[model samples]
Target: MDLYAPFVRHVVAPLHALYEGNPIYSILRELEQTQWLSPEELRRRQWEKLERMVRHAGDRCPFYRERFAAAGLDPARFTLEDFQRLPALTKADIRKETPRLQAEGMQDVRIRQGRTGGSTSVPLEFVVDERSAQRKGACALRHNAWAGWHPGDKVAMVWGATDVDSTFKLRMRNLILDRRFALDTLRLDEAMMHDFARRMRSEQPRVVYGHSHSTYILACFMKKHGYAAPTVKTVVSTSTVLADVERAEIENMFQCKVFDRYGCEEVSLISSECDRHEGMHINLDHLFVEFLQNGRPVGPGECGEIHLTDLTNVAMPFLRYKVEDAGTPTAHVCSCGRGMPMMEKVQGRVADFIVTPDGRVIFGVSILDNFTAKFMGLERVQIIQDVIDHLIVKIVRGEGFDEKVVRGFQDRIPEFFGKEMRYDLEFVDEIPREISGKYRFTISKIPNPFQEAAGRAIGRTPPA
Candidate 1:
């Protein structure tokens, strides 16, 4: 029934590519075939690309040149171990040494400046070249295909992104080629959800995409109010952590598979879940990823901090960049037969980990989802650990919320956080969002275990 999708995918896309002299279409075709390469072959290719990128960065980039020399690493002959010995790039480093991070003699290439969403309250400015942009776009397309979404398919978005440029050309492109139905999540209310649900029921978009929490919230609203959302072919959840309970709720409400994606503005697409839904397949072709603990790579199934080296971005090479995220790497090969490696799971951000009074550290997600969320009459919850022995529990009340819920928390706080921990409940009409329009369910004010171990390397000072 949707004839426009085929026209946009075939004709409009190619014409736009030709008009702009963009190679993304060709690059996408190449990635489509490369996804099937053997795992060993992919790793070999990654190593080759890494070698080339390292040499380029060391020779041309002032920042890497100084860093490599200080580390006593020769780009021409350094082994993988030597490369690992190089210092991890922090957001502070990027902020301070942005100009030096850029490669020299890049006057011919088109480069653009950008900033991160500051979801962690630490925004970063960086640059990306034209080729890197094209490649990242192509990589996204390849992953979208895995979720049953193509370039031209109608996609309803519940994103809180503020980076879009609504120029006339882009508006035309969205209207014709992209066919996007976007819901701005900067300020979501019941009225907005009603309108969104109403439009979705009539439009029947092929794909639904949004921040994980925002999408889940929309689905919850629709279900509670008896709004009939269309059953799209695929739902893509990205930007924030997608908990298992939230995933189940989204799937049940939308009647489709929720493909969770992980990435950042600094690096476009890191990994995405495929049709098989086993785990997220890493984009090995574009990034050299490492899971580190105590300055060394961790074994499979063990949690570690993620370090990324972008092999594709020559203008600004991010070698062993500390992404401030934690994830568990896995050696399990996917049955989908993709040669790309998999990550067992992405643990929440490092800043989201709470430090106990007894010096034990635990992920905030465990406290929020596994324990507090099960409480009855709770519409939303945010747990803030200001100090080791105190917590501020922010709750948005739903129907039937009363003293019983407060009593429930009083009993469970000791059971979960120990007897020494004290808490104050603040009933809120709605929880606030970050500047980037994403909601953080749990926030910790104190330094985590990794911060203490890494010290200033992670740009955070540990308690003396």
Candidate 2:
């Protein structure tokens, strides 16, 4: 061990934490120790923290206080089951009740602004506590270590909306943090891709990370042009679903493993794949995740909507906050021997669901993934379900894609959604991204009819 570890931990790190108002290094130190505990030990510690969080929310938040009272919870004697009795926090709640949900002393908290891509037509502008960002950074550092990358390692991002301003402060920070380069993924033409490849050769970043589709496209371009660039040790795929073929192709071209990460802007670093690759481990020490189907906790291996409680983000406690994403829980321990439990996969988002006239909800993301990838000459596709009967399909035209493909879509899509469905497939040169500059493969406008009635239907006892 380095002799300065003591000086840095006891002196230098504390100064940084005080200045930044985030105990990043301190949390990182704690996280390193927590990962070694057994699964039961981890759960025991997590449960204790969760109990405190529940009581804190009930005491500090006016909205949660009212909810607690309604659930007959005596905050002093609350159990885990009593905590689950609280209602799920929905996006509408975030939009309308943020002030009510916020803690009483939030006025002095140093909060940061965050926003979603607004694919739901109601974009959310929420605030995160300053420390949540720090904790997330620490979790990321811990995960990156699994890929043989460390805190100061150079990493290039093939991502969108990167701030590349030449301001002195920004430049100094980027240099210090080792943000060597960030490829503008918005423009991936031949020249841009070639320049990106050239930059990778020059920068030799230890890790290359980006959107799953963008990474796959870059891999394809590199193979097509036969441009051999210096290798990066690992590539991280996030922000969208990573298809099986996309993961295989990216790994083959980059000659490194592609680790899939699942998260949203609302909560950061939800789950990540370790080197063993058996499944993605949940960040249990910081988050408590529940898989709910029909408003009840689904057992392991069953699919459900992801409900998360942030143990670390105390500024705005989103207890049992619905993530609007579907996921499955794993039953077994990982072969790698990590203490954290596993989440099999983030199935997809509810915004991607296709709802029908009779209240049928279809997991459109998976269905579309299955159909589109099988067909040739299909660059991209988005399913827009504005109405129950008429489905507007947008496609990026590729070679050999013409009227015959449109006829095939007319048959295949309706057969999957419902026989009564009508398809109007429109071919386009490109499908522009949302205002947030993030790509969503599917956008559904039809409201989920079962959302409101789910709680009452799912094993709820009738009142006396």
Best-performing candidate as measured by lDDT: 1
The residue-by-residue lDDT of candidate 2 on 1-464, one tens digit each, is 22443454356546756787676777888998888799999999998888888888887999888888998887788777877788898877888998887777767777777766444456666677877767777887778777776655567777765664468886875665445577676655678888888888777776777777677778877876787746778988876667787788888888889988777777777888999898899999889999998778999998888899988777888889887677789887888888999988666632266776655786654655577776777777777877778778888876667777877777787667778887788777887765433455666666663333221101100000
State residue 188's C-alpha deviation in candidate 1, in Å.
1.7
In the predicted model 1, the residue pairs found to clash are: none
lDDT of 1 by residue, 1-464 (tens): 77888888888888989898998889999999999999989999999999999999999999999999999999998799999989999887998999899999999989877676345455678888989978988898889889988877888888764323378876776787778777888877778788889999888898998888788888889888998878698999886778888899999998989998888777788889999999999999899999999899999999988999999999899999988778889988899999999996677642277677876777766775778767878998888888889999899999779899999889988878878888899999998876656666778778765542221111110000
Candidate 2 clashes: the total is 0
In model 2, where is the ten-residue run with the lowest total lDDT? Answer: 455-464
Model 2 CA lDDT for position 103: 76
Of candidate 1, the 10-residue stretch with the lowest lDDT total is 455-464
Candidate 1 residues lying further than 4 Å off, grouped into runs, are 120-122, 162-165, 450-464
